[model samples]
Target: MEYRRRTVLRAGTAGIAAAVAGCLGSNSTDDEGSIAGEELALATTTSTYDTGLLDEINAAFQERFGAQVAANAQGTGQAIESARNGNADVILVHARSQEDEFMRNGYGVNRRDLMFNDFVIVGPSDDPAGVSDTEQATAAFEAIADVQAMFVSRGDDSGTHTKEMVIWAEASSEPGGEWYQETGDGMGDTLMIADESNAYTLADRGTFLSMQDNLDLEILLQGPIEGGPELLANPYGIMAINPEIHPNVNYQLAMAYIGFVTSPEGQDVIGNYTSNGQQLFFPEALSDDPNFQQYVPDGWQPNSNGE
Candidate 1:
């Protein structure tokens, strides 16, 4: 695949970073030695950044490869487009359908299952919409819409935004007028705004948990394991941009990143990462184990094809 070369480069850098000084090497390099100026560019989602996962990954990657990883954290839609336009060498996103389309079009290759976290509906503790403890996301959304409750949406075409749209569609509600508000910002910012406005919003559990101390809102609903619906499963994946379609892309570096992130060592970091003493990402490799899958929803699948 055209993305193979860039993938190799990314993987090699990550390997080097891991072998050297671990995560400390990331801050030691200048922009010229970073992935942005060298062999790779990573485009990812805001959720990863808000949860502090990307920083950890970047530090380790830089230490192993001695190369800086220039990462643009945006909505999944924009991230995929970045790769399509040769603006990025790799992508880490949670939108499966969009990722599939990108791969089907030859924009990227060698997509691998990286990590996963579930989505949660957050709102005031008073439960204005009476959506707390709801098992069906669609029904919860319906109640929120019917009441015209204050709702804040990322509205940035991000993976979380896309999932919210799906739930709204399933609930047959259109967000408009005063009932809905759109904030084309990252997850952390959106949560802050939501808290200030006392509105409801859909967010990744990791981000919500990490930002919990700064906000007063509570989780209204969680995934099936947490009594939420099965449709709330959120899986994250990584893919390298296809060099054949965009000759300037660094295929080798992108692939190296893919290998490192999906490797056992990388998975261990992901699984062990915590905020407020709660694990943020659940490793797919251990998902089948009784302990690991205990909190995961049934019928959930790890996305590996990037599609």
Candidate 2:
């Protein structure tokens, strides 16, 4: 899959000065050379890039560490594949199952619970298939499937695609035929396709809200953020590519980037990022004890108390 890359270049002097002044409160100007002239390759989901959160946070990070960042936007599956192939130094994504698999395969390390949002079922404003009346996400999906209402799917094996498949499994409905359309694309493009087709689809709340103004879609069913089902909770994680597997990876820079994002400063930027007065991603790593279980595979320890 041809993934689009967005490089977070060093901001202008005024922007860098502003970040150095406050965004990174205690970092002195002398500390800029700590990772000076380094470029960290980041593999992440479209939601982060689409929502423009990286642009805000990377400005501060570049000023503080003097390292440029190239954030590649694509599906979670593609992101992981990039990391596994040693094309990216670090990855930030929301697919827990895939993350667990990557760790189990010894392709990544230093996995940190980074942030979260939720998924919402969106559709045409007229509410075809009566999706608006449904209480659960699965129920809404079932209704759409029942009526064979045109349902657009992010069929590119993304995190959103994984969640959509799960919901379909729970509803015991095989989504296919003329009613089910697969757009093997990222969240932003898939949404545009859905909107143009008058179709219902599952989307991350952040990306949806970021582009809501130009869309005809409405949130017919809420996710965890709106007091909906736990299944829709979209927790994201950041992990560094294990140097042992691929010596070419910038493991040191990756870990540094990880620390900054999970730090209080990083969490603050994430928590404060908003679209049209609505908070997008919530911070998940500020704590007395950091999450160590992210290092282990899922279900390896039944009492691990993780995620």
Say which candidate scores most in TM-score: 2
lDDT of 1: 0.77
Candidate 1: tens digits of C-alpha lDDT, residues 50-110 = 8998999877766666566878888888888777877887899998878877876878776
Query: How do the predictions measure up, each by TM-score?
Result: 0.81, 0.88
Deviation (Å) of 297 in candidate 2: 2.6
| Predictions in order: lDDT | 0.77, 0.84
Q: Give the TM-score of candidate 1.
A: 0.81
Which pairs of residues collide in candidate 2? Answer: none
For model 2, how does the per-residue alpha-carbon lDDT over 56-156 read when each residue is reduced to its tens digit?
88887886688889888889999999888888888999999999999989999878899999999999999879998989888898899898999999998
Off by over 4 Å in 1: 1-39, 285-307
* Candidate achieving the largest lDDT: 2
